[model samples]
Structures are given as C-alpha cells and as structure tokens.
Target: MAVEEILERLTRGVRDMDEELAAEAAQDALANQMPALTAINDGLVRGMNEAGRLYETQEYFVPELLLCSDAMYAGLGILSPHIQRAEEESRAKVVIGVMQGDTHDIGKNLVKLMLEVDGFEVFDLGRDVTPADFVAKVKETGAELLGMSTLMSTTMDAMGVAIRMLQQEGLREQTTVMIGGGPISQAFADLIGADGYAENATGAVREARRLLASRGAAVR
Candidate 1:
C-alpha cells in the first residue's frame, strides 16, 4: 500500500476500534519503510485525538475511549520497536501509578496509554503504589514527571504523602508532580503542593507537556 493508504488504514483502524486492522496497518507501514514516528503521530495519535474530542463532546464514553485506546496500542506494539533509537531515546521519561491503598487503575491506565501515544516513555507502577516506591522509582529512573491517580477519596492523601517523600528524598525539585482521577480536583492538587492537575487522560497529556516545558525539559 502507498504511505497515504497505509496511514489511512492505521487511522481508520483506531477510529473503528479494530485492533487487528491497526496492527496489520502498522506492519504494512513498517514494511514500507515508513518512519515509525510518522506512522504513530500521523496515524494512531490522530485517531486517538478524534476519540478524545468525541469523549469531550459526550459522543464517546469511557467504554468507547477504552476501545479506541486498545486500537492505538495495537498499532503501537507493532511500530514502537522499529523506532530509531535516537528518536526513541529523546522521549521524556515519566513515572505513573495509582496511589497506595487504591486498587483502581482504569484512569491511570488510560493516562499511561495517552502519554505513551504522545511519545513519553512511561514507567507504570501499577495500583496500590507506596510513596516510598514512587520516590524510589523516580530516583532510579531520573524521570522528569510523576503522575498519580486514585478513584477513592480515602486514598487521596497518598498523593500528598508521595510528594513529601519526594521532597524528603531531595527529588522534588527534579520531578514535576501531576495528579488525577475522579475524586481529585485542581484545588486539592494545589493544596497538596502538586505541580499540576488533570481531570482526564487528555488533560493529563496536555498538563504533562506543559509541566515538562516549564521545567525546560525536552519533549518530543
């Protein structure tokens, strides 16, 4: 297929939530020597952006968004390994997790997916992550950003704890903190001394970019 045709197939596959088709299109793009970044940015990410728009307009709900992300990842799995090391290495590293005591991860997972599609190298810490673990991961990875999520109001304090841990570890200045999930608010984020707050996956991606830019961190 022509590059345009391949890109169209990749885009349509994500828009239609067809995992197999997205993967196939991604393979075709790779076989055609299309740049992996081009296929991702021009195809998968474009489709995910449309899905985000629909979600904001209420035309697509959580379920639909999840499916769309599935398609996006399907393409990503096929293309990401083929990306040039220099290009891949340029992506900013980000640490993400669900706060301790909270088992919910749907929101966190979505944010991770969006960040990956946007070219951020994400280290997902999974659910019920401890403040020490978050701090440890940041120290170990030297990540530029930390994103946390929790669905339970009771578990929200863990976000604050994690921040304090970062400060205590002397990593606070080096890392930008962002929080989200249904129970989290901008006011709450500010109160906890978080660097940023986002209500959803789309907003998280935007906030992450803004935070990185503010820190003079290079973002591809």
Candidate 2:
C-alpha cells in the first residue's frame, strides 16, 4: 500500500476506535519502510487530536475518548520500538503527573503521549501523585520540565504546593513548570508561579516545546 494510504488507515483506525485496524496499519507502515516518527506524528497523533476535538465539542465523551486512546496505543506499541535512539541523550526530560487528591488522568495521559512523540524523555507519576513525589522525581532525574494536572478545583492547590517544594529544593530555577486541567487557567498558573499553562493536550505539547526552546534546551 502507498504510504499515504497506510497513514490514513492508521488515523482512521484510531479516530474510529478500531484497535485492530490501527495495529494492522502500523504494521503496514513499518513493512513499507516508513519512518516510525512520521507514522506516529502524521497518523496516530492526528487521529488522537481529532478525537480530542470531538470530545471538546461533546460529540464524544470520556468512554469514546478512552477507546480512541486504546487504538492509538495499539499502534504506538508497534511503532514506538522502531524510533531511532541515537539522539536520545539530547532529548529534554519531563516529569508529569496528576496532583494529589485527584484521580483524573485522561488528560495527563494524552499529554504524556504527545510529549513522548515530540522527543521528550517522560517520567509519568500517574494519578493522585503527591507534591513531594513530583519534586523527588525532578530531583532524581534532573528533569528540565515539570508538568502537573488536576480535574478538581480542590486538588488544584496541590500544583502550587508542588511548585513551592521545587522552589524549596532550589530546583525551581532549573525546572520549567507547566500546569493544566479542567479547573486550571493561565491566571492560576501565574498565581502559582508556573512557567506556562496549557488548556489541552495539544496546547501542553506546544507550551512544553516553547518553554524548553526559550530556555535554550533541546526539543524534538
């Protein structure tokens, strides 16, 4: 099959929430000698982005979104291993997690996938992560970027607490912090002294890249 045809299949598979089709198309892309990165960014990511848009418009809900993510991951499992690793050492490192007191992680998971596709070395701390754990991971990894999210207004304060911990550890100057989730806004980010704020997963990737570039750090 043509590269375009295979890529479209991959995108359609994810957008339609068909995991088997996505996996098959991913295999086809590899068999056709297509670059793994191209297949991911141009195919799976595009599909996931569309799914996100659908969710934003209320055409799809959390369940549909999760199914699409499953399809995307099905493809990713096949293509991710094929990504070139020669420049791995130069990629920026990111530590991401949902704040304490919140179990919502769909948004965080999407952001994580986008960051990985964009060539960042990601360490995901999963849901209900404590402020101390966030700081500890950043200190351990010497990560340049720290991303935190929360769906509840009550849990939002934990993001600020995490930032404070980073500051107390003297890691604030070296880490670029980004905050997001349903209750988060740019004003909140500024109030919490975060380096940036992202309203969505795509915005998260853009903000991450821009923040890293502004710091003269390698991105992509």
Candidate 3:
C-alpha cells in the first residue's frame, strides 16, 4: 500500500476503534519504503488526541482509552529511539511517578509515554513510591523536571510532602515539580507549592515544558 493510503487507513482504524487494524497499520508504516517518521508521528498523535477527547467527554472509559494508547505506543516505539538520538546532545530529563499508597498508574504512565514521544527523557518510578524516594531520584538523576501522580484523595497529601521535602533539602530550587492525578487541581497544586499542575497528560507536558523553559532548561 502507498504511504498515504497506509496513513489514511491508520487514521480510520483509530476513528472506528479497530484495534487490530490500528496495530497492523502501525507496523505497515514502520516497514514502508518512504520516510515513516512523519506519517507515524502524525497518526500516533492524532489517535492519542482523539482518545484524549473521548476520555474528557466520558464517551470512553479507561480500558478503551488504554487500547488506543496501546496503538499510539505501537507507532511511538519506532519513533522514540530516533527521536532521542536526533537529540542525543539532550532534549530534557524528567522524573515521574505515582505517590506513595497510590497503586494506580494509568495516568502517570500515559504522561510518561506521551512526554517520551515529545522527545523528553523520562525516569519512571512506578507506583507506591514515597516522597523521599522521589527526592532521591531527582538528586541522583539530576532531572530538570519532576512529575508526580496521586489517583486517590487519600494519597493527595503526598504531593505536598514531596514538594516540601524538595524545599527542605534545597532541591526545589533546582528541580521543578509538576503534580497531577484525579484529586489534583490548580488550587491544590498552588497550595502544595508545586511549580505546575496538569489536569491531564497533555497539559502535564505543556506545563512541565513551560516551567522548565522559564527556568532556562535545556529543552522547554
């Protein structure tokens, strides 16, 4: 199939929720004769954007969104290494994770994946992580940005704990904190003294980039 046709089919697969075809189309794009990066990146971002809209409107739940994300990943896996090498000098480094007691990681994982696609280096801490661990990772990695997730109201306090710990240890001045999750909000993020608050994955990337840029980070 022609590259245009393959990209068109990929778009249709995502719009129609044909998971199998979406995956296949991604692979075809990978193996196609011409430059695959532009087409695959466009299709991947478009599909993920559609999924984000579906999620925001409550038209699709987590499982379906996850599947669409999987399709995006199918394409992104091909692009990310190239994207990273394209910027081997460095784009940016980020530390991301879910807070302690928050075992859920869907939102956090999505943010990590999307950020990586955008060419930012990410260090994921998995789930059930403490504030000290987050701080330690930041200190060790020298990440430019720190992103945190808390899915439950009960664990929301952990975001503040992490932020305060940063301030206490003088890391706050060096690393910017970007916090989010179900219970997280702009007001609360301010209350916790986070550098930024993202309502969702895209916003997280945008905010993190903005904060890092303002701080004159390598990539903003």
Candidate 4:
C-alpha cells in the first residue's frame, strides 16, 4: 500500500479503536520507510483529534475515548523506536506525578506518553507522590518542567504544597510547573502559581511547549 493509504488506515484504526489494526498500520508505515513522526502526527494524532471532537459532541464517552487512546498508543509504541529525535542526547527533561493522597493515573499516563512522543524525556513519579519527592526529583534530575496530576479536589492542595517546597528549596527558578486532572481548572492553576494548565493530554503537550518557550528554553 502507498504511504497515504497506510496513514489513512492508521487514522481510521485509532478512530475505530482497533488497536491491532493501528499497530499493524504503524508497522507497515515503518516498513515502507514513512517518517515515524509523520505517521504519529498525521495519522494517530489526527485520529485522536477526531476522537476529541466526538467526545465533545457526546458521540463518544469515557470508555470509547480510552479505547481510542489505547489504539493510538499501540501505534505509537510501534513507531516510537523509528522516530529520530533531533536532540536525543539533550532532550528536555520533564518530571511528572500524581499528587499526594490521590492515586488516579490514567490521565497522567496519557500525558506522559504524549510528552514522550513529542520528544520530551519524562520521569514519571507515579501516583500519590509527596511534595518532598517532587522537589527532590527536580533537584536530582535537574528537570526543566514538573507536571502534577490529581483526580480529587481534596488532594489538589498537594500541588500547591509541592510548588511551595520548590520555592523554599530554591528550585522554582530552575523548573516550570504544569498541572492537570479531573478537578483542576485554569483559575485554580493560576491561584496555585502554576506556569500552565492543560485540560487533556493533547493540550498538555502544547502547553508544555509554550511554557518551555516562555522560559527561554527549547522544547525538544
């Protein structure tokens, strides 16, 4: 099949939530020497955008969205190895985690995957992470960005505590902070002094780039 046909199939596979087809199409794209980045962006990401639209229209619910995301990631796993990152040796490092007392991670995982596919090296700290742990990781890894997630309104305060810890430890200037999850909002992010807020994985990638650029740092 032609590259266009393969990419189209990949896109359809994702929209249909056919993980096997998406992965197969990705392999075909690789075998045909299609640019992995092209396959990911023009194919999987495009399909995900369509899924997002469907979700907004209420044509697709959480289960369907999750399935679509699974299909997208199936293709991503196949194409990721072939994608050549421009600054592989010094890719921007990002530290991510779910805040203390909150264990939800589906959204956090998706954000990490999207960030990685966009060429950012992510250090995922998993769920229920403490403020000290977040601060220590930034200081230890010298990461340029810190991303926090929480599904509960109660645990939201953990993000603020983490940021304050960073400030007290003198690490705030060296790292940018972004937040997301079920109970988070732009106003809350602003109140917590976050650098940015994203509603979903796609927005997270864009926001991460904008935040990095605003800090005079390179996104890749």
Question: Whose TM-score is greatest here?
Answer: 1
Task: Kindly list the per-residue Cα lDDT of model 1 for residues 1-220, writing each as its tens digit.
Answer: 7899998889888878899999999999999999998999899988888888888888988898889989998898889888887666578999999989999998899899889888899999999999899889999999999998999999999899999989998999989999999899999999999999998899899999998998898897
Q: Write the per-residue lDDT of candidate 4 for residues 38-157, one digit (tens) a residue.
A: 898889977777776786678987788789989998998899888787514468999999999999998898788678766788999999999999999999999999999999999999
Q: Rank the candidates by TM-score, best first.
A: 1, 2, 4, 3
Highest lDDT model number: 1
Whole-model alpha-carbon lDDT for candidate 3:
0.79
Q: What is the lDDT of residue 217 in candidate 1?
A: 89
Error of 3 at 150 (Å): 0.9
Writing each residue's lDDT as its tens digit, candidate 2 over 79-189 gives 989987662447799999999999999889988977876668899999999999999999999999999999999999989899999999999999999999999999999
Question: Candidate 3, 29: how far from true, in Å?
Answer: 2.3
Model with the higher TM-score, candidate 3 or 4: 4
Q: In model 2, where is the ten-residue run with the lowest total lDDT?
A: 83-92
How does each model score on TM-score? Answer: 0.95, 0.87, 0.83, 0.85
Candidate 3: which stretches are off by over 4 Å?
11-17, 34-36, 77-84, 87-89
- What TM-score should be assigned to candidate 3? 0.83
lDDT of 4: 0.89
Which RMSD values do the candidates have, in order?
Answer: 1.3, 2.3, 2.8, 2.5
- What local lDDT score does residue 202 receive in model 4, on the 0 to 100 scale? 72
